[model samples]
Target: MPARRQAPVTSHIWASGGRHLWPSGEASALQSHERGHLVYAASGVLAVHTERGTSIVPANRIAWTPARFAHHHRAHGDTDMRIVFLAPSLARLVPAHPTVFLATDLAREVLLALTGPRNSDYDQSARSRLSRVLVGELREAQEQPLQLPEPHDDRLQALAQLLYENPGDNTSLAEHGRHIGASARTLSRLFHDELGMTFYEWRTQLRIYHALVLLAEGRDATQTAFACGWANPSHFIAAFTAIIGTTPGRYRTN
Candidate 1:
């Protein structure tokens, strides 16, 4: 028999859920708020970028960035972004680094209840109980590798920023390194040490990450493939599926 999908465990955690909306391609300025928060994309996809890495938060995913972690957010498609500030105690339940969590059904319902229309039905005590449950559920939730770690070396940083800005560029790492005044060997070493991945692997991850944004903007697979520097649609599909756990065709941004 096939395995059944488990329903999301319901609970609540946010001391305050501040809701906001973003049109496709809109992004917040790089920032560091005083409080930590859980960011949820109820209708679209979002990318949360910090010093550590970029976390992709799709409709099925939630992103948690700790307090004072300088970060920015970008929307894919038209996003209904929801935020819940965490108290220091509740924030402890999430990791210090940015992370992506699968949004389960129960969690979604709980989030809507807490953050959506005011619930006169639930008094302060009920809401508090719900918050604890939500936090606990998120704490135990499995994390996804929807994050792309950032590089630190000057040359590598240049390369990463270049790729991030123009993911469709077909420049090879060795070629990029040469233009940046570094040898392929040195660049490879930097990538492995600083970013913990090979040049090719890192580029693949970056391309796929960009592909998510493009696809979420409702771009077709072939167009997205070209945009992400994948010459072949079949190759692009395989890479996106391997990294994102889904085929690009079904990876809805809208």
Candidate 2:
């Protein structure tokens, strides 16, 4: 998510789960599993990119990827990623699509236990029980607004790429429309119909995504605010807190 760094992406796989240690910017190859799985960032942050959208997984959130959905993962900082694959029966309890969920204390503990290095210590019955508890915990947790939905239209895709490439770009939607050969009114309709949000709302989410990455990289709130196109740091803090459920400074500390 930030500048790419040279560090090996180390993965340890077992029967039902595994753990990965990735350096900042380390990314996994695009691939899909036969089973749905939950991914949690024990440290740092992970951006799970799929055709549907990108779900940002911070320490306080967990991401679910449905079976066979092509996706990849990128670390925003030195990240310890824990993953636990679910059997069809267990997966049915969660959403069928890729989603980010608020991680309660119980859910976090369950995730860590499922993917811990000594997971082998748990027998089959014990593992299955833990898996059930983990899924049950997540099933009740609230879905988070950490996902940035991707647009399908070619014009919208182009515009999205432009903003993605430079999140600090302050160009208005109308100006972006002209540059992409579409009228602002047309783009607005497409956004509402296809993406279910206004241009400004989508842009704000995109900026929040970038802000999370910047914060993960240890940047201060003020710096991350400006880097993500917020002219006023206070406004950025408010927007971030509203969506992320925590202020940037507190988020960093946590």
Candidate 3:
């Protein structure tokens, strides 16, 4: 039998650019930095959480986060990704909010070059030139919206954890309330009070997050639908489209 290879950590750069991959449902730490970040999954799905909301980045899409934004990043499934750090001054050229951009070929190439090892030896002047080019490209890039609201209350946070742990579980509000030691009516109020959305809306977003991971791994829509708790493929497609403005087929394709 062939040897099973361990997942690679690849590289981590101190302040410029780096590339790495994360498997399904994997999450990074809540981190804040002085520099801004651009996170892209060249082939997979990524979900990033900031104070404002969660942004879902599909393949060929990049997520931009401004400086000093405390955020966490996650990958749904076998996500091939790149993370670029920009100086605070340069980041002002792009939008301050979390936005997704369509990664064109030239933009992709520049990103790749920056993260590649060949440019490591470049002098300060060369690095500055590359940074300027990247900022220019990002300024001209088209944006896509894939924002999902974050849960703020402890009760809602607990509920979200339960759903994440068991995506296949079809627990109702009453069941969840019982488990969490709250009444169904109380839970309903908490949803609005904390998450700014209803329980069903939050559940739909969670399911879509899981579906994005499976789709990125090249799973068929039907399989992904069943895996993420949808009764049927059509239902999954509809929900996914309603939230992401694109189908799983298009979301996965670069």
Candidate 4:
């Protein structure tokens, strides 16, 4: 007899069915499916990028991505990933794009159960009901704006990595350019070409993202502002409001 081919492990419409841990610099290729996806980081952080934006999902948070949206996912450092896929009909409650949110303990437990062995002989009605409930809870969950807009050039990419590593660095564009071996004008042009924003605007966006992370960790705005390289708290607040669509305090409350 001819050798039989094993079925592929990956499926389009299915539960998590397993817990996956990823090491630093690990990444998944760009993929799109008819079923929506929920990606949770159990221990460290995961970064997700879609056509809409880039989400920085830390532990205790989950990123919901709707069906048919091309995207890529990766772990920043050593991280744990729990992924669940929902059928198209069940996923309609969520927007047709990516949204990040805080995952409740109950939801977390249910997500964990998804990775367990399946009961092949049992009726699947109970499983379907549970999955429906999870989908509902996930849809009504608060939407968080913890995303950073990505720049589209090598220079800005390098600068972004530096800013992310040290949010407190208060270097001017000229100074940063010197460190990155580029002239101020060249850097500015690169920022405009890649990010569609000025160098200062891009820096402000980075600071705001850092501020959100700090604030989520229970830091006050004033402290976060200084920590994110803003000379004045007021300036930080203004920039945060401009890009984030609300005051820092209001944004954090959700």
Task: Give me the candidate number with maximum lDDT.
Answer: 2
Residue 3's lDDT in candidate 4 = 18
Cα error of candidate 2 at position 11, Å: 1.8
How many clashes in each candidate? 6, 0, 1, 0
- TM-score versus the correct structure, for each prediction: 0.84, 0.95, 0.73, 0.60
After superposing candidate 3, which stretches have Cα over 4 Å from the reference? 1-8, 12-15, 21-30, 49-54, 95-109, 116-150, 168-175, 178-189
Residues forming the 10-long window of minimal summed lDDT in candidate 3:
1-10
Two-way lDDT contest, 1 vs 4, winner = 1
Instruction: Please identify which of the two predictions, 1 or 3, would achieve the higher TM-score against the true structure.
Output: 1
Candidate 3 residue-wise lDDT, 47-90, digit = tens: 88888878888766678998888988777677767888888788
Q: How close is each model in CA RMSD to the real structure?
A: 8.2, 1.9, 5.3, 9.0
Task: Indicate whether candidate 1 or candidate 2 has the larger TM-score.
Answer: 2
How many angstroms is residue 55 displaced in model 2 relative to the true structure, after the best TM-score fit? 0.9
lDDT of 2 by residue, 1-254 (tens): 23333456888998898999998888887889999989999999999989988899988899999999999899988999999999999998899889999999998998898898779899989999999998888888888858889899999999999998999999999999999999999999999999999999999999998998899999999999999998999999999999988899999998
Query: How high is the lDDT of residue 97 in model 2?
Result: 89
Model 4, position 236: C-alpha lDDT score: 86
Per-residue lDDT value at 191 in model 1: 86
Off by over 4 Å in 4: 1-18, 116-123, 151-168, 172-254
